[model samples]
Target: MKKLKNVLMVALIVLSIVAIAGCKNDDGNETTNDNKEVNNSVDSNDDKNNDDNDKSDTDNSDNAQEDDLSGLVSVSGSTSVEKIGIATAEEFMALNPDVTVTYESIGSSNGVKNAKDGVTIFGTASRNLKTEEKNWGLTETVIAHDGVAVITHPSNSANELTKEQVQAIYKGEITNWKDVGGEDEEIVVVSREDGSGTRGAFEEIVEFEDSLTKDAIIAKGNGNVQTTVAKNEKAIGYVSFTYINDTVKPFKIDGVEPTAENVVNGDYSISRPFLVIYKEENMTKESKAFLEFVLSDEGQMIVEEKGGIKVN
Candidate 1:
């Protein structure tokens, strides 16, 4: 009986040992599986974070590319385009504080020459490019259309004049205003100087050529023409439509009123294009941006506000 009891106690001890070993093995397996799951979850989170970081970096790079514009843009050209150009430049510079836009109001011919010679990045002109100019790698971008106003003193009684009558007056054939339905005073014809864009456009439109009277007063710019006409009651001159105001009276050409709407719709006879010329291959980023700005809604607003018609 003592031997049997000892055997039973040994058996009990063996069983306890086995049960503890079994529990240890099961716990080890559970611990290993939990570790594996935790590691996989951490790796997934890392990959997701890396992808989000990469996307954020790409977006920042794209934004930098879109917003990073800075440089010097030079503009030189037509006196006729001076107001619009300067006004646009002012607004553009305000938007891009790092950019500098310079405008020189030389004659249109000089503006074209300067562009070809690389003296200026932008060449503004009131007339369309000539055939020879197009062959020289100069591209004209027409920004606006403008009318040439035949202005006289407000005191002048001439309300309207036909094209032929204007040509006759410039030709010195109609020296007296009475001939064209005005006062009997002698008509003082004012003309823009040679190489003036306004003068060129006007002469070409009127077919005046060399027929303008030699005694006709020569003004340097539209402002001068307006000034001269404003001071003299018998004076008659032509200027850009932008220059027309209460200081002088604008005449109806062929019965159509000289106005921005009329000029844009082709109803006005004596009108010309306002052009900006550039070498396409040599254009800089800032210049391209400036061109875009000029065609934008804000730029068009500036054009209209400055008394010019917007083409775009």
Candidate 2:
């Protein structure tokens, strides 16, 4: 009876050990299956996230590159902004490589009208816009500052003049350069024709009426004024700052030199802000981007380097 009882106990122990081993194997298989599912799920989520990240990066990159204008840009209107526009366009083209800028130095009023009529993408002007211009859907942008400078032949030694004297000269009040500290030669004043921003600014500042007497000779453009003045020793003319390099010595008004620094600091009273006008009804992403660039720090640098006031 004792031997049978001991054998029964050993058999029960073996059965219990086998049952525990089987249960452990079942648990191990379930754990392996769960782990596989979790890994697959994790891999799917990671791939999905990676795809999203790649797409987002691509979109951002595309946007950054989209601002790069690779086509032609039509610029027109202000002779005052002509230099700045040309320089900025050249710089922009250098970076864009595939873009081109075509500019027309038409009168500012014509430019504003053309832009309002959707004839050009951009228009430049030397003066502020009129209320009627606003009614034409024109929006103004300040691109740079330009100083109206008095230019004469290199032979003339009149380096400075009071505002009153300058005004007198334009008004035919001072007919001779000798009257204002120069040679005894009679002064030949070259002026811009009507509808010219430069001429308007000069006349408004000096209070001269249209259709002046024989004392002042009205030319068409600033370039013509420069040429006419530079060629004649008795000639004096008001021209844009960009046209006043070695060819012409810009006179100091009331002993204050017209300079970019002076203009920025408000010491140059004849200085005016160069403007770009656009039609509000015909705005495009291209137009806004170009205008934004013109008003940016980089654009201001371009203006300064090209002899315009930094008005950023």
Candidate 3:
């Protein structure tokens, strides 16, 4: 009976060991396999996210390359070129968000001086450079053509004036409006001040020869001249044709109107060149690009829209 009991206990011990091994084989292997599969899925997802991030970075880099033009283009000179310069600069900058363009309207001669002195990246002149200015090695780029319009208060009766009459009025020889077929009011001659591009061109066209009448009221800038004439019914002033508004009447010169078409077609004789001057040796890349743009079809369109003659 004791031997039988010992055999029975050994059998029980063997059965317990077999059951423990079976549980481990079934549950532990399943947990390990599940963990392995989850790890692989997580790795796959991480790889996809990393690839997406890399592609995103590359796309941004390409976009940056396409719009990489960045620099300052500073243009100063010629109050008469104000509209043209501003229009072109604005459009250029809009296309190149990373670039900057600025225009400062001082005067034509000063603009040329600034270009030669390297004080500005570009300078504007409404008239051709003087012989000495050209001797300074500065180069001129003609952007557009402008006509000098002789304006008066809208109430004036005269619609046309000969070249000689316009010259005499500026020279103080024709002080009364009646002398020019207008009302008998005494003419208030408003002239642009010294250093003005409009004044230079007008004086040259009419053969003022530095002989502008001393009695003329000197106004600065086209706006100023426009204002002076618009307020005084007897006032007569000359401005860029672009500056003409309903506030003032632009007189016909020898039966030709001061229009862009007339100027480009060569019927408007009292015209001048609007120039952008620079030192070729010292020109920056940005200025060259801007000058090219100013001469381009889009640039000349702005010139025409601004009431200047298109060069192209």
Candidate 4:
């Protein structure tokens, strides 16, 4: 009876071992199938994500070339340097056919204020901004250098005037052209509007703050000042060298002509930097790229070609 019990015990042990092995084999097959499904799902999701990323990249590139710059970039200010801005804008539009840049020939002060108020993406200034302008969240980039030319109507044969004489005329101290050896006509003073950057430079350089309070015909811009001086025989106006041509004659200041070469070499007395202002926070990639192009050698060449002095 003891022998019979031992055999039964051995048989039970063998059956238990086989059952455990079979359960392990079933679990192993189930785990393998589960792992395969998980891997396939992971791979499919990864491929879908990769495709989405690729599509996003492609869209960005196309947008950079098309839709991103499809709107107008408003620029204003610095009548002293409007021609330069206009010419640059023309070329810039051509390169970035997606962007249309429109610049107004407003005076420099208006330009600074407009840019500060977020009315314009860029502001042109023939002079630097004052200390208070920083509060407007405006940052400036010097685009070019320019020299102010004292211009008179072509009929006036007076070739030049000393700095003192030019200052006196603007200050209302010297009223007659005859006093400066031109003609016997009263000097019709044509000056820029009060907010003009060129006007600030003119006053600062000649120390005319105390004396320029008198009334003078206030033309809106350098171009307007040139036109006013050219049309009126008795007029004398300060204009930028870029605007000087046959219609008006530029007067030598202290025996120096306001030529591009002179201005570049620091021989010109009334030279100032031309600036473009933009807001620090509102800058976009398009704005950054456009500005980068302007500051490049290609942009500087454009400035020189447009009869303006290149800064870099």
RMSD of each: 2.7, 5.1, 5.5, 7.8
Model 4 agreement with the true structure over 1-312: per-residue lDDT tens digits: 999999999999999999999999999999999999999999999999999999999999987666566667788898877887888788888888878888898788888888888888888888878888877778899988888899998889788899899888988889988898887888888887788899888888877865673668988878889999999999989987788889999998889988989988877888889999988776666677677877889889988887789887
Writing each residue's lDDT as its tens digit, candidate 1 over 1-312 gives 999999999999999999999999999999999999999999999999999999999999998887777888988888888999999999999888888899999878889888888898988888877778888888888887899999999999989999999999998888999998998999999998887888889998998888999889998989999999999999999999889999999999999999998987888899998999988876999999999999899998988887889987
Q: Tell me the RMSD of model 4 versus the true structure.
A: 7.8
- The residue pairs that clash in candidate 1, if any, are none
Q: Which is better, 2 or 4, measured by TM-score?
A: 2
Clashes of each: 0, 0, 0, 0
Q: TM-score of predicted model 2?
A: 0.79
Provide the TM-score for each candidate, comma-separated.
0.88, 0.79, 0.79, 0.76
Higher-ranked by lDDT: 2 or 3: 3
Candidate 2 wrong stretches, greater than 4 Å: 1-72, 97-99
lDDT of 2 by residue, 194-278 (tens): 7788877766776665635565787888888998887898888898888887877788898899887887788878867788888
For model 2, where is the 10-residue window of minimal lDDT? 206-215
Q: Tell me which residue pairs clash in candidate 4.
A: none
Candidate 4, backbone clash total: 0
TM-score computed on alpha carbons, candidate 4: 0.76
C-alpha local distance difference test of each model: 0.90, 0.81, 0.89, 0.85
